[model samples]
Each structure stands twice: as C-alpha cells, then as structure tokens.
Target: MNDSHSAELLRYAAFTADPAGGNPAGVVLDATGLDAADQLAVAADLGYSETAFLTPAAAGGRAFAVRYFSPRAEVPFCGHATVAAAVALAERIGAGELLFETKAGPVPVLVEAGPDGVLAATLTSVEPHVEPVAAADLTEALAALGWSDGELDPAFPPRVAYAGARHLVLAAATRARLAELSYDFERLAALMTRLDLTTLQLVYRESEHVFHVRDPFPVGGVVEDPATGAAAAALGAYLREVHGVQEAELTLHQGEDLGRPGVLRVELRAGDPRIRVSGTAVPIGPRRG
Candidate 1:
C-alpha cells in the first residue's frame, strides 16, 4: 500500500496461527532493489531460520520471482518462507492463486481462508525424487546426531530425498529417540554442506496417517526448525516411494517438544509427482525494531 510498508521486512510464524509458534520467517514482499548482499544482511539481521525475498515477476501480476536465504546462506527453496509470503500476498490481494519463480523451479501456491477465518497457504513442490544413502554416510550421520544405528526404523530406512530442496530422511524407531535431539552442530553442519542438504528430516510415525517430525537445520544457523515445509514434501515423496502409496493425506506434528507447536499437512495425489504442503501463518509483532 505505502512505500514505507513495502520497504520494511514482514515477520510471520508459518504453519501456525500463533505468533510464537511454528517457524518464524521474514518476508520481503517487494525486494525490487535489494542485491544479494542486502538480502543476506536482512535475513541475518532477522535471525530467523529463513526469509523470503520477492520481486514482481516481469511476466505479469500475481507472479513473483522469489529467493530464500537462511541466516547464513541462501537456499534454493524454503517451504515455510513460501507459506509466509503467499499468506502475506493473499492478505493484501485476496486469497486465490499465486506463482513463484524459484531457483528450484516454478511453484504454485493456493491461499484461502480457513474455517476459523485465518488464511492458509498450500504450496505444490517441484518434482521430487529419493535416493539411497551410502552405508558409510549413514553411519557418519548417526554419529553426528549422537544416535546409534539400532535407533533407526528399519521400515523407513535411510534416503536423501528432494522436493523443493534436498533433505536427509531418517526415521527414528521411537518417539523418545526423536525428541532427544542433541547433535554435534559443526559435524552435522559439515555433513549437510557436503551433501547439499537443507535439513535433516527426523521422523517417527505415530499412526498410519499421523506422524511426528523434526528438522535439524544446522546449515541455517538455527538449532531446529519448528516446521519444515520442504522437508515435509520430501518426506511425503519418500513415503510414497517406500510404501508404494498411490494417494494419501498425512498430518505432521512438529515443534511441540520445543513448546512452539505446528501442524503441516502433506498431500500426495496419484500420478502427480509434486507433493503439496499446506499450513497457516500469522504475523508477528513489530519487526526489525
């Protein structure tokens, strides 16, 4: 609306309506003149897990070119930031369809008001695929995480999955094992950097359709991400590959252990390579003060 408002970075907690919950993200609705260094500086100053910088696409209205940056580095894709940006746009221009030209690929987002009147955004990820993890690498990952090989669930196995961004998918045998997340930060960060991973998707299946998940995001300069949309999309594709599921709706509960509870809804449609991750976001208090 105003030049002053568009110039300031907007802060929102994605995947939940509560400002204190979910993964906080910085949304620069109009980063038209900001350079790479400027974007990085803004993200680092905000100190969130990640931030979204958007410029109106040359193609037309309702389309934008978006880039995601973590506190330390720029990422190819970021789910929570996308959620935050889409909702932010919807709030101003009415909820419906939006397109983002991302480094990973072109992503489509749908924003609509939920039953409770809060806006929710659904993002369809890029084509996703899964690859087997090498035995030595798996052992090294477990060591960095302070977890033993036996703690892993045999059913889920180990894999490097990619949706919008790459993530290492590791399923713990028990919920307790997943909760006690004390990892070697530097070691894990090195491993993630070498693998070009955005985060480690640590998961435990609560039921056939419900799961509890956490993300170790050392690369982002954050201990953990309360809700990880990219990881969720990767996990959804991983499940489809491992279990041969055609279509399903699964609920991922995250951030509860950290007292910032968040819910991410993952959907897989038969014959569709892209996974859809949906959640709500709420604006936080005055930012960059």
Candidate 2:
C-alpha cells in the first residue's frame, strides 16, 4: 500500500471508551483513491474483523458513502466499525448527525457527548427482519458448534435475523453453555458460508433486559468479534418479533469471554421496525502485528 493510503488509516476501539476493551476497527476517513482491493488489503493487514472506508458523498455535507471490508471479504454492513468511524468523525468535526450510505441502505447516525463526557454514536439500522432457520440448517449449525438441541434455550428458538447483515441467533440455555466456546472453525465456516451468515449470535439472557453475548465470525475470518453491533440490532428485532417486546432498551455484554469486554445498547421502539444500537468508541494508538 502507498504511504499516503496507509497514513489515512485510523484505529479505534468501538463499544467501549477504554482502548483495551471493545472491538478494534480501522477507519479510513478519506478513501476516495482506494479501490475495493486496496480497502480489503488494508483490512487484512490491520487484522481487524472489519474496517470502514469512507468517501465524500456527491451531495456532501456531513454525508459519506461508506463501505465495510472484513479481512477476507466485504460485508454488507458492520456495527462496530460504523460506531468507530462515526465517533472518529465526531471527534474531528464535532458531534452531530451524519448519514452513511451503505450497501444495506442509508444508515443515519447520531453522535453526542454522554453525561460522563464520553462521545457515543448511535446508528439507526435499516428495517430489520427475522426469519426462521430450516430444521436441517439449524441441525448443521448445532453440529458445527458442538451444541445440541438440549443445550439451546427453548424460549429463544433458533432463527436467522437481519439488521444490516444476516446472523443466526442461537440462545444458550445457560450462561455456562455460552462461556465455553470451543467449536469446529472450519466446519462452522462452511455452514455459515452456505447459509450466507456473517456471525453466530450466541447469547444467554441474564435478565429481562440484560444479556451476555458472543459472536463467532468465521465468515469474516475472525474467530470472534469482541463487540458486535449488527448482531445486537438483529437480536432486538428478534426479541420484538418473537418475545413480543414492543419497546424497551436492552443491554448486551459481549467480548467478555475473550477478555475484551464491551457493552452494546439496543433500543427497540414501538411502531418502528428499525433498530438503534448505541456505543462509545475511543481512538487507540498504533499496534504492530
């Protein structure tokens, strides 16, 4: 990569104010000159689960065309990266509203300082939908993850959910079941690839409005995503649809299993099909691979 292109890369940890926590994402504030391959190469080099590349929109005031690239491929949308990019921009341009035109759709983001003086970004996802996972597909997924029907929560039936991207939502019957995450990586990757899934949203409900979650992101070439915004949004939709939770704010605790703990706040509003995910992101210094 060219030195100038490399110079444009900014690193941040999303979903947490602490640099050591959250999911780290690379953000290219100006990627007007970078092509798809260049963006992918940068993401792969950084070894982050995903990166955000932005180009000024044609009608440019506080608007940009954003694309997300994983280490191995381009994803339709990414929550943590979006939050990172938005916070990065807010730090420079001042907090406010920004619009991102993404592959999934137009995503509206709001950035503002929280009561604690930390900047937080909230992205409103495109209309989300939840669908059933075929019995055979669910069976394959269970086999790949080394989970059985008995291990799954009977209340939260297995389903494929979509906010900006698709994820298979599987709720564990117990917190212990969610903690031990040794799985067949290649086998899970194959199943996810066939199912066009981005990650497996493994979760255990700690309370009515609290959950502990983990995302296995083999499709993105990452063993796990420390904090997953997209899946959290999908989970909101799933809760609304299946659990009849019309309106409520839910807190998701993720990345704890990997020791990079972060928080994701999911808001579901009555009469609105879109999900809103909010989190704080902080810039991190350069790291060598």
Q: Report the C-alpha lDDT of model 2 over 44-70, residue by residue, as the tens digit.
A: 988999999999988799999999999
> What are the lDDT scores of the predictions, listed in order?
0.93, 0.94
Model 2 has an lDDT value of 0.94
Q: Please identify model 2 stretches exceeding 4 Å from their true place.
A: 1-7, 287-289
Candidate 1 Cα errors over 4 Å, as ranges:
1-6, 287-289
| Clashes within 3 Å, all models in order | 0, 0
lDDT of 1: 0.93
- lDDT by residue (1-289, candidate 1, tens digit) is 2232335799999999999999899999889878877888788888999999999998888999999999899999999999999999999999999999999999999999989999999999999999998888888899999999899998998999999899999999999999999999999999999999999999999999899999999998999999999999999999999888779999999999899999999999999989999999999998552
Which 10-residue span in candidate 1 carries the lowest summed lDDT?
A: 1-10
